[model samples]
Target: MSLLTVKNISLAFGGPLLLDGAELTIRDGERLCLLGRNGAGKTTLMRVLNGDLPPDGGDIMRRQGLRTALVTQDVPADLEGTVFPIIASGLGEQAALLEEFHQVSRSLQSSTDPALMERLAQLQKRIEETGGWQMQQLVEQVIRHLKLEGDAAFAHLSGGVKRRVMLGRALVSDPDLLLLDEPTNHLDLETIAWLEDFLVRRDKALMFVTHDRSFLRRVATRIVELDRGRLSSWQCDYDTYVQRREEQLEAEEKQAAEFDKKLVQEEKWIRQGIKARRTRNMGRVRALRQMREERRARRERSGTADLAVQQGERSGRRVIEAEHISYAWTGQPIIRDFSTTILRGDKIGIIGPNGSGKTTLLQLLLGRLKPDEGRVKLGTNLEIAYFDQHRGQLDEDRSVQDNIAEGNDWVEINGQRKHVIGYLRDFLFPPERARSPVRTLSGGERNRLLLAKLFTRPANLLVLDEPTNDLDLETLELLEGLLVDFPGTVLLVSHDRAFLDNVVTSTLVLEGEGRVGEYVGGYEDWQRQRAEQIEDEEKKPQAAAEKVQPQRPGRDRPRKLGFKEKRELEALPARIEELEAEQATIHEQMANPDFYRDHGDEVAQLQQRLEQIARELEQGYARWEELEALEG
Candidate 1:
């Protein structure tokens, strides 16, 4: 069933049209992921679909009584109140009565004054008279479903939790369609994973715009892209969509080339002499004029960001070394007995829950915060450029060009001088946009500005804290490529699984209780190794119990492993290595851009084989450990 349909929708600001005759049908039970460049009017289209913004032209047909809710990109600054009232606000007209009833009811729980009880009774009577009982129940249910405390102040919640509150507010109305813009912007890995699971399990229709590729892959049933003021739907997953979209762009370019060639020939013929302008050729002249108009109106795709990292003089082999570092906040251990050595050219990812001190760890390593009990040593000639997740490095009051050039007309990159506007253009900023105040820029543009600013200086050490936030997939992948090829060491703090998997060589996971575990490989690798470690730990208790227990009088000693089992145990290491080797080979094969185009069908098979190999290697390692424990 279709919940809403947009037909011939066109919207325009003062400049180019944002949505030019865009058409879409949002059906029930479909999760559509909206993809586009930063300023391609994705949010505007979302707003139009939600009926918050009226399109300049076209019709939107909604099923009778169909409800829709939207969570905007940024939380409204003036949104205030406890969680319950905020959620109840979704119930139009009866929200005040329900809020008063809730407040009076809670007051009576603590103080059973006659006045309080009377007020509560009166409020309840009003709520019942207005037939808001079901709506009240819905408000509570949404809070419970979202795991939010009904009485907690919305102002006190973390950004992620605040987003959840907003989501709950949207859901309280039991909307038929939910539209979210950049839903994963401030979410941590655990919260993102939980949200992915939650949305996948929900039956409602969802249309979300997100830069998180992993979240998009797991949640989207279909992919829709907004490009050059037009919407294109891809009925496939993100990876397949990438391949097909590339092929589409290539075909469009070829057709455009042929059209341009024909237009040139027509121009040459029309310019050639008096015979072409004769009475019989008047129709041809009119056709050429139409072709010129068509060519003038064509909107080409926006250019990709040109990103480069300037390299400084080589740093010492040892970039940073922390010895038995212990840090505490409010007398609680955040990083305890954590120690590691970072070398040049090493890319490390730091991951943890929202408040689990990922940034604290980064500060400790950078010698910004003194460890309470241990020492951190920094290497020599380590010129550092940091990408702050909060974007604190950027000046909001200054124009984008001024922020980068600092009132100068030119800036130096890698010892070469470039004009400020030209440099901003490399980041996809036009002259007008580059002159706009930083505060007026979108989140993606702000992030790009920060990158442009950071890359201006030569640095041998790059410390990025959640640098992928608000970046488009194209820009994010470009940054990934830059990091991968960077000659210096990188300390990246990101929750983006794909980015981490693509760029980092190792991971530092902040397990609870002040334990920081180091693991080789990326996010998926850590998951596999951690799962195996947990399995080994779970088996240790049973193995110990068997060893300590007294033997039965008639039972023979625990039977030794058979010849086949012993052979299997001994060969497990070699088998695990073989599987790992194959996994690496597959990864290498898939890394090339040409791989998707050349061997598209093999991608899924390769992914399945990787999973199979991981499982087998995990089982083999576990079995080997089990056998060794028994033998001991």
Candidate 2:
């Protein structure tokens, strides 16, 4: 059933036109991933659906009594109070009912008034109707899952923590429709995986904006891509969506002479998708418009930026060597007895849950922090370029060009002097945008600018922390291409599964409690190996138990059975066959993609139950063998 319909939605912010007669129908149980380049107005469109921003011309119709919750990209500074109360407020009606119910109960306890009893009864009825307890329980679960500090003030929390809180609020609301902008932003790999499982299990309609390709593959049932003030819907996963889009574009190109208008439309959408990530707020729309000419000029002049990272003087074969490194802060050890060797041209990706000391390890390697025990040796002629998640090197007060130039008229690229504007263009920043304050640029644009700065300086080692954050799919691909092509050694910490798979040669996994291990291959391969390790560990105890168990006399043969047991065992083979057939059906269902996507939780339960059934079937066969021996 369709929960919300957006018809003829035309919105323009007096700058670039967005959502030109766009039409979207959101159905129940649909997990739609919204994708687009920066400045493509994806956020604006989401705001329209959220009723936070009304379209210039359109109609948003929702089913009667349909509830909706939105998690915005930026956490509002004005949202005061502690995290717990703020999140509890998202429960809406149920929150009020719960409070009223508690108040009425208190009143009845204090005085035996009949009126109090009546009020308490009414509140109780409403609470049960709204599932007030369930709503409260969900809120608590969300908080715990997101690792929120319940007592922390909203303003005092970090940006990432604040974003998590907002996400928790929206999820806990238990709305019919949930809209999230950059839902995966500021989340670690563990949290992202947890959220993927959470979304897969929930039947609620979800529309989330994310650049995480793996996330889209796991969670999205449909994709609504916003481009060139239009929306294109695809009922498929991320990979299929890209394949279909490419094939369509290829066919359009082949028939371009006859369908020039159609070709133009396709190209416009492609051009819109090339820009990368969205700005921090919609207010920057005018500034974005100023770059339109630059965008056009660049298209007319050349294709995408040639991001050739200039390698500095060659470092020794050993780029970095750590000897028995141990670090502790206030009696709590973050990294203990960790040792690693980084050779020249080696690309390593660091991954772990949030607060797993990935960043601290990077800092320690760079000599920013001294280890309590052991030493880190840097190779000769090593010049390291670090890209932090916070983009701390960027000066918000400085113009983009100034930030890049750093008071110089030009930058040296490959030992050649390049004009600041030309260099900025290489990072997808237009000449006009170069003059805009760094703070005014979108997160994606700022990240690009940061990359631009990093590449200008010659480096033998590159250290990137969450570099994929705020980057669009296209830019992410470009980054991966650059990393793959770069001669320098790379030590990267990113939650992007696809990006890590494409770029890194090895992975460093930081398991909490001071455990670290290295694995060959990317995130996916590492995860597979880890899962196998866990399975092996689980089987060890069972294997040991079976091996150490006492054996009865004549165990090699079968044990004797009484007459009643013999009759029961006679039916065991047929029962075992029935279970095997049932298991086959469940396996078939699990193998079906649609079944798993639609009923993830049920499928998981079925898998567990199937194992139990298999064991039971095996036991039945064993009993039947014993009974057959008695007949013999």
Candidate 3:
């Protein structure tokens, strides 16, 4: 059944019509993905559907009393309290019911008066009516799935963690419709895979905007695109959507070309002959005029930007070398005894989980951070241009031109002076937009500005940290092309699987331990190798254990273990279970609103301890698996 219907939705801003009579029907259990170039009406349309924005003209018909939740892109920076309280607030009515029930229970515990008994009974009835217990269970599940620390301060978490908390809040609501904006943007590959599985098992409808191709293929059941002020739908997977959209665009272009040719021929015939104005030729003239009007009114798709990066002076064969480098934060090791020599023209990708120190390693290599133990040496004549993920260098109050020129009207590119506006045009910023403040630009535009600034410096080594964050597909493609064609050494830290696959030749992996390993391909290639390696390890261990089977088939002998090994073998499982129980207790404490409200200051400390326990639990599980293999 269709859950919502949008009819003749018309919206416009100051510059142009964003959505021209757009219409859509969102059905139940549909996993829809919205796609388009940056600055299209995708987010705007989502806001309208989520009831945050009203279209200039439209009729939105939704199921009566349908619950919907939108996980917006912007994190609530001003939101107070710990993660638990923030997410619990999304429970809406159920939260109220639970709070009232708790209050009644507290009162009843102190006084067994007749009035208290009546209030407690009413509160219990309301809690049952609203399914408060079930809602609480769902909220806990979301929090655990996302690995969010309920007691952690919402404002202190990283951008990625903040995004995860927001996602958890929306999921806990158990809404009929879920609206997600770039849900997978800041998540690691593992978290993305988990979310894909989570959404796949869900029956509720989902509509999200993301540029992650692999995620789209795995999560989207239907694909919709906002193009040329209209919405186009494809009831297919990511691969099929791409193929069909290209075919449709090709057909349209051919049809328009044919019409244009015929109209030109008719116009020539009417002009070349004096009798063309007669009654017989009137029909041909009218058709020609109609074709002209149609062509003029049609809004063609915008052209792709030309992103060209010229090669700088060649450096020595070795671009960068880390000789036994080690870095630690407060005695917690991030990188230890790691050594890698980056050669000229090498495109290496750095990947791992969120806190694996990929960005830290990049800084260490680029001379931004001094190593704690070993030396980081650069090649002769080495010039580095680093693109920081935070975009801290850009001034939001300044104009695009001012930023690019850095208080000057001209920027030197390869020893030649170029006007700032002319250089900005290369990155798709027109003359008018160049004068606008950086704050007004979209994410993609800001990314483009970063690129523009990076190129003006002329460096042989390019270091990018999460460069694909705010970039659209077109700009990503352009950046990929530029990287492929550039004659320089590149080191990148990105979470984008497809982008990494297309650009990088090798990868450096950090597993959040003090170890860094090398892989000879992109993210997918690394995953494949890792899976095969694990399989091989499992098979070898099993085969070895089978070879050491009891000498006599009829005699069953108990396996003997040394004192240390025996104690470890006996205590590991119990320890694992104890850790798990502790985690559950922490989660329960955090999920309770009353507890969180009363102990907000203790939340951060508890979260830190919880994180430590989680790490230990993971290590313990791995050790348990190894012990089991040995016992076998």
Candidate 4:
């Protein structure tokens, strides 16, 4: 059955029509992805779905009994409330009524009137029948699956954590209709994986508004695009959507071009006719007039060029190297004995779970950190620029042009003291938006401004952290093209798997605790490895068990330890201690700035690896320790 239907929905903000004649339908178990450039009315459409924004001219049909919810990035930053109350929003009116019903039922059960007792029993049964007892567990599962496993206060949590809390809130009630607005924006890779798995088993219809390509591919069964206030739907996944959308745009462009050419030709011929051509050729003139009328009726679809990032000459043969580096935060070591080497034009992507020190490693490479125990080295003439996730370099109070202008004190084009307006124009910023403060710009705009700043720098090696945030699809495509053609090297920390696939030739993944792994190829190669691992496990379940845990299965009796097991247990403690020491050393090295100038990037990378190895070593040790201390 159709869960909800929207027809001819239209909404206007000030003078600009955010949505016009947008139509969409959500069916039972349907998964749809809403795609468009930033400010293209996706969020507004979601609001229309929830009936929160009554369209200026439209009607909606919904199931007689169904609930809906939206999860957006505005997950109140200064959340003073408990996580329990946050998740309760998904319950909608049922939660409120449930509470009121429970209180009234309790009061009724205590009354002497026989009618009251019967009514109380009926209400109690209804509440229990509605899965009241199971609801809390559902909420907890949502909480855990989204990976918000900590009890820290909301203010202390990162934006990503709070976003997960909001996600949990949205999923707790299992509403008939779900609207997810950029759910994966701030989530870590681990959480994203968990979400992908969770969404696969979801029964409720889902309408996801997101720019994350991987998330769309994993979760969406259909794609809908909002163009010029009109919504069009496609029956396909993200890859298929890409092809279809491109074809549609190409066809539309061709039609518009042909119509325009014919209109020009008609006008030219009409002008050329003059008095020499006569009323005798009246039919031809009439034909030209009809052609102009047809041309006027034809719709024109226009596309703007995405931003362009130019890469300057390579700095040196050896761009960056790190040696025996170590770093720690609040006594928790992140990098240990890490070493890595970067060649000219190497587009390296650093990825891992959150708190894996991906950002810290970037800082160390860019000479922002002083390794406690080792040194980081850079090649002579190597210039580096860093783009942090928060856009730390950009002045929030200043204009977008001010930020870019600060990169170089001089002007670039014609040396006319390039104003902030000129720089912003090159970035596709309109004249009205040029003077706007950085705080007023949308996510995509800010990201564009950041890119503009990066391109204007003297750096040959760019280290970008979470550069995909708030960026539109157009800009991402531009970035991918730029990276592919860039002459200089790039070292990046990004969670966008698709972006990594397109732009990165090599990968350095930092698994928390101080270990980092290097892989060649992009996301496809990584997925293949994971698939092989799964296949191998299926082929040898017993072996896999032995590799990960005890080999015993379906056994009530515990097996006695063999000599090999005993030796393994005995060596584990000492091994764990060695790793702990190594982790400490790597953290110290990552903290030192001299490491960048004195050693190779390989040294810094080795320190990163040591950090990861230390983590694995600890896990192994802990497992062995458990084996040795078994009560069995």
For 430-505, candidate 4 gives per-residue lDDT tens digits of 6677667899877777878888877665667878888887676776777888778877888878778899999998
Give the top-scoring candidate (lDDT): 1
lDDT of each: 0.85, 0.78, 0.80, 0.72
Task: Candidate 2: give the clashing pairs.
Answer: 38-276, 38-277
lDDT of 2 at 326: 89
Q: Model 2 over residues 1-632: C-alpha lDDT tens digits?
A: 99999988888867557777889999999999988876678888878887789889878998999888888767787899777767887887676675565455445444555555455556545655676645655665677778887668899988988999999888877789899888888888878877898889899999988888899888989999886677889988788888998898678556644444544544454456434324233444444454454444321212356576778988899988988888987788888888988899999999988887899988888778899999998888889898988999999999999988888888888889999998888777777778899988887887888888888888989999998887777778888988998888999999889889989999999887877888999998898778656545554565575675533234244334434555687788789889989876875664454553455346335635654775576567657765677678
Error of 3 at 386 (Å): 1.1
lDDT for 1 in candidate 2 is: 97
Ranking by lDDT: 1, 3, 2, 4
**Structural similarity to truth (TM-score) of each candidate:** 0.81, 0.75, 0.80, 0.73
Clash count for each candidate, listed in order shown: 0, 2, 0, 55
Candidate with the larger TM-score of 3 and 4: 3
The C-alpha stretches of model 3 lying farther than 4 A from their native spots are: 97-134, 155-160, 263-285, 406-422, 539-541, 548-632
Predicted structure 4: clash tally: 55
Worst 10 residues of 4 by lDDT: 550-559
What candidate 2 gets wrong by more than 4 Å, as runs, is 97-130, 251-305, 548-632
lDDT of 3 at 56: 91
Q: After best superposition, candidate 3 residue 117: deviation in angstroms?
A: 16
Sort the candidates on TM-score, descending order. Answer: 1, 3, 2, 4
